[model samples]
Target: MTAKPPTPVRRFGSIVGTVLTYVAIWLGLVLLIAGVGIRWFWGRITVRDMMISLQNVDLPAGYTREWQGFYGIVVAPLVIVLILAACHAGHALRVRTRRLGAWDQRPRRQRRRTRALSLGLALILVVTGASVFSSSVGLADFVRASRSTMDIGDYYAAPEVTGSENQRNIVNIYLESGEQTLSDTNLFEKDPYAPLEEQTSDWQSIEDYQQYQGGGWTMAGLVSSQCGIPLKGTIAPWYGGGNTAPPDSIRTYLQGTTCLGDVFKQQGYKNVFMGGARAEFASKDTFLQDHGYDEVKDLDLWKNSGESEKDFRPDWGLSDQRLLDHAKDEIDRLHAESEKTGQPFNLSMLTLDTHEPATAYDYCPVDTESRLISVYQCSMEQVAGYVDYMKDKGYLDDTAVVIQGDHLKHMTSSDSFHEQLDRNDHRSIVNRVWVPGQENKRRLRPGIDQLSMYPTLLEAAGLDIRDHSAGLGVSAFTDAIPGGSAQALGPRGYRELVATDSKDFYTRAWDGEEVHG
Candidate 1:
């Protein structure tokens, strides 16, 4: 007896089920690949950091490899789905052509077992994908940390600027991925910071300069050192709401908080910022403009300059060599104006050659076996040369220079120094300070982090801050810290405070409210 064909409704339901199954398979594969890829690229980044990076998605040209890898991962799932569809199509065609006799007439028990196994495989994929994805994005960690109710506002201290007797010109340089760990000859083959250290041998150095939580990136580092607070994003994952999304919607950056630039502006200093990367890359320009920078020069300015296109790096903008050369000219012009007008100026700049996926410039010789190390050496050499130029021009007599790392090197899988850095437990941010007419050098107070740099920088520039405190930090220039300040809380306690969720406190900060105890 011949069996009758299925009803139209039954055929339609069958088609829908097949389509849903393929969708599920593709989604599962995509989730798994993306989760694994994120881990491979950025190694267990915090959810706050991830959110900030996502909201400000202006990536530099140097991240070509990362972009290409992401595209491949996304397409992999589609390729897999297509192959599965082709296999199903071939099986259906064989059945329709009647090429196999008992293919569709297999035992009911065998068919049921096959269906059960396939369902089991699908379940495994979905579960594994969800697990990996959640872990990679720090979802579990965020949830755990949300339970704590530590408020930064409790320890916050508003900067009390009592005015300086003699305002000195300030030159602050933020080194990309600068860490003293790179100078540990015990870990690596040689010290990449040797040139920089030799140049600033007479400058005061800060020891045990810990990198606090939330200050592990460039923007975060900038905020922490200048504003004396961790850079928190608007997302309140604990509440499952975006109540404080000002960073995305508003042009003002931390309008409620007082930063180095703001203080310098009040002091009648002409604040200027220059960098090799685009100022708009991470809304850096917005932050500087809002905070009180008079002039901001970046990749756009360099592109418009009459320099050869070959002078620029394809990934980031200009090479450190070119950036420092331009910086010399800027300082000369600024200094001349300051001398004539008797007005002190602030010049801040960030270097780019030491950024990840670093490349060697033609002007710099390859002294080390690793290209990354050579790049580091070359970049440091250029910065050191710039310092020498400042010294030659007699700017050091009336200037305060602060040279520090923006943050520790990100130990992603693509980074070259992870093998050495991962093993060392005593890693710290590299920093050097130069104050005008200082006869003796004093060690910075122990157990202080980037927060202390806020007051420290102000003091270096001849400003007198009350209690040597600003925001949550106490100036490293003094041994005494206020009783309730964040520095007095110690590094361990400070980390715990910053790790927890402080939505209300941060909301006030973003809203430009004066938050203080």
Candidate 2:
């Protein structure tokens, strides 16, 4: 006898199960792709960095290739979902033609095949989920760090800056992905930094300039060196109020901390920042403004100033040539203003040509086989020219020029320097300091990291800092190590401390609350 039609409840349950199955499959595919894609694009990244990038979606020009990759990742899942939908629709149609009990009476081989397919998909989902959780999210590390007793706030030292009698003008330049390891002739065909190195031959170089944990990206590097603290996610997910969202979502970027700009501003310095990319990309503008910068000149400034689009690089914003040219003009104006009013100025700039997926500018010579190497050389040449201009104008006689890499190069699988960088064992940040009459005269303390730069930059600019400490950093210009300072932690301890979660300390920092041990 023919079976009665299935009840409404039964049909509803079946439909729910089918929908849930497809949802699970789609989620599984997305996780798998994202896990693999993130690794391919950025190698290994911190959860903090990942979360920050997600919240701040304004990517720089160097990420144009990555944008295309992201588009593929999004489309791939939809395509699979569509195919599955079609197959399920056809199956539903066939099932509709049979009695309710006939589905169970189907061939044993077909039923077994269906079960096997479901089991296979389930296995894939489980494996992908676990892999993504452990590696990409760093679940195990996070748990361990969360339970650790090390408190960053306890090690923190508030800056006590004393103005110098001369009050020298400051020129800070952040070179993108400027690892000194790239200069090793054993690894690379030639040193891309040769031109810039020649210009700063007399400048004091940091012998062991380490890239501390959490300072692996541009914003992090800027914050760490300037504010004397590693840039960490302020949000505590377990807590209800603190959410480490983008800078736009918040009122201020690290309002609780005192930075280089703040100190300079308090010293009556007219602080300004210029860059080859959008200042808003990673909330760099917000950080600068929050930290007492008087003005910001970025991609928007170049665009709005009626500069031709042809002058700008298609990937980021402008070439190093144009950026340095404008920088010269800016310094001239700032210098003239400083001469008129007794107020010194701080001119800070960030170069962008050496960023990943490097593009060759029209002015760059094809001296090297690798486009990355050529672009780096061209960027250095432009920077060297700027340095010469500063020297010619006699700014170097009074100005303190600090040049350093923002971070180590992010070597993806596709990067030209990946293999070479991987082979190197002693990679370090490239840095040079020019302190007025003390050019190449003052010796920086060895084994210092970016954290030490906060006080070092201040001291270089003719300021006297109490205890030779600011935040966790002890001034690298002094041989004396302050008790309970980051330098006193030693290399391994300092590294481990910075790598810890330090959730409460960071939360206080983000909340603009005074943190105590």
Candidate 3:
């Protein structure tokens, strides 16, 4: 029997040879492709392309050519190689399993080759795709002006919280996709998101403030509007997020890292930081804390429980209604403190009820058609409802409601929106301020951003500490409120304002610490 076994050792030399050859080919191909893509993408060439990324950041003409070339050659390629290697290793292991082993000898060298091939292919696909996609994202598309036309130093502030008031109560509401059209026919009235006007018709009195176009995304517009973080340089989701450090914001200096919230907190005002979305998303909490918030409210604590995905609502975790459910409780707490100290309160509500990808809330009219309009109206009405709720609680009269959009949605700018609504438009921020009673009646202002809203509220309420300088768009109700033309200062002015703001902030938050804070 032993001698008979020597007669046959499974003669499959041809099969083994063929598989090994193919494995080698794929391995080489994957590596070649991945290496090429990594080098090209990682270069980060700042060669001035007219195309501006969402943050209006582009490889400036004469930027760092060496760095760009480095990415194309070293950094990105290395990352790509690693990613591809992982994928290929998995594939190589899979190919050497019992089934494939019948055809090949499962040689260690051959297995290694096949794994590298699979991994390289995966790396090439990922890096190449990201590079290509980043080139065309909506943020990069809308910016038409070259960097030369914009001045970063004008609006530039160093890394510090910019302050404007001593005890101004600031409330910024970021509407999901609030786009205002020529006829007031918003695009949020459809399947995904509903309009706020439909639910809270009381806002019908003031609809002119919600503007559209210019900068489309939130990081671009909201960042610029709120903190004077221009839509000019370095777009975000930046690789390092400009390092979430205090004294880095574009607000003011007297309080340094201290914003309107810090200003009020110092003035004995309660800083209530509330948001309907993830509280910790995008270091918003860090920014708030540096600016002087004692407690940043997490609107969706329910989502944190050790529960399955099924527990979440169609809108992810909670609806605007659910958040509204607790609005009274939050407000009551604020009121209790206000009563105790006779000190004013600062309420910053960063709402996400109007968030897109899920149009869970009812539109203002209840008859939805355009998704952009519908969702915005729903959120706006929620804004209105919040006011009413406050009115019933007697807090509405004193509270300065700042309602604005986080940024516009990309889906709304696609060809589908053009065909559906017969329009080509970008989502604008819902940057309107609502102040009840006689004080605001004489000067009802228009739209603004989270950054600007903070300072503007402080100003309107007569709460100034350090002088704010880098603001592009003035307070909606600034002393010289634009009474006629709503023509906002162009992108050039905005860029100038943002670029120069942060230095002043740091000058106050840190450099000026001995003099101010």
Point out the worst 10-residue segment of candidate 2 by lDDT.
236-245
- The Cα error of candidate 1 at residue 288, in Å, is 0.3
What ranges in model 2 sit over 4 Å off? 1-143, 236-249, 515-517
Encode model 2's per-residue lDDT on 1-517: one tens digit a residue: 4334557885686577667667777777777777776665555555655655665455346656457556655778778978988997887678857745254455556655775677578568857855884586555555555567887888888888765786789999999998888898888879999999999998888887988765677887898899888877655412212123254334567777788998898998999999989988767888899899999999988989888777787778887889999999999999999889978999999999999787777788777778888889999999999999999999988889999999888654455676666445588999988998744497888768888899998888788888888878888888998777767876656755786767778877778776543
TM-score against native, each model: 0.74, 0.74, 0.54
Residue-wise lDDT of candidate 1 within 1-517, one digit each (tens)? 3334446885676576677677778878887987787676665656766665555454346655456555656778889989999999898888877844433455545645765676567668877887887888777666756775677778877888886886799999999999888888877778888888898999888887888765677887888899888777554322222211223224567777888899989988999999999888657887889888999999999999876777788888888899999999999999999999988999999999989777777887887778888888888999999999999999999989999999898764456875677556688998888987852276667657888889999888889899999877888889987787776665556666776667787777767776775
- Per-candidate RMSD, Å: 6.4, 6.8, 14.6
CA deviation > 4 Å runs, candidate 3? 1-170, 186-222, 231-258, 304-316, 361-381, 412-428, 444-454, 464-473, 479-517
**Residue 200, model 1: Cα distance from true site in angstroms:** 1.0
- In TM-score terms, candidate 2 sits at 0.74
| Cα misplacement distance, residue 339 of candidate 2 (Å) | 2.0
Better of 1 and 3 by TM-score: 1
Ranking by lDDT: 1, 2, 3
- lDDT of candidate 2 at residue 126, scale 0 to 100: 51
* lDDT of every predicted structure (CA atoms): 0.79, 0.79, 0.46
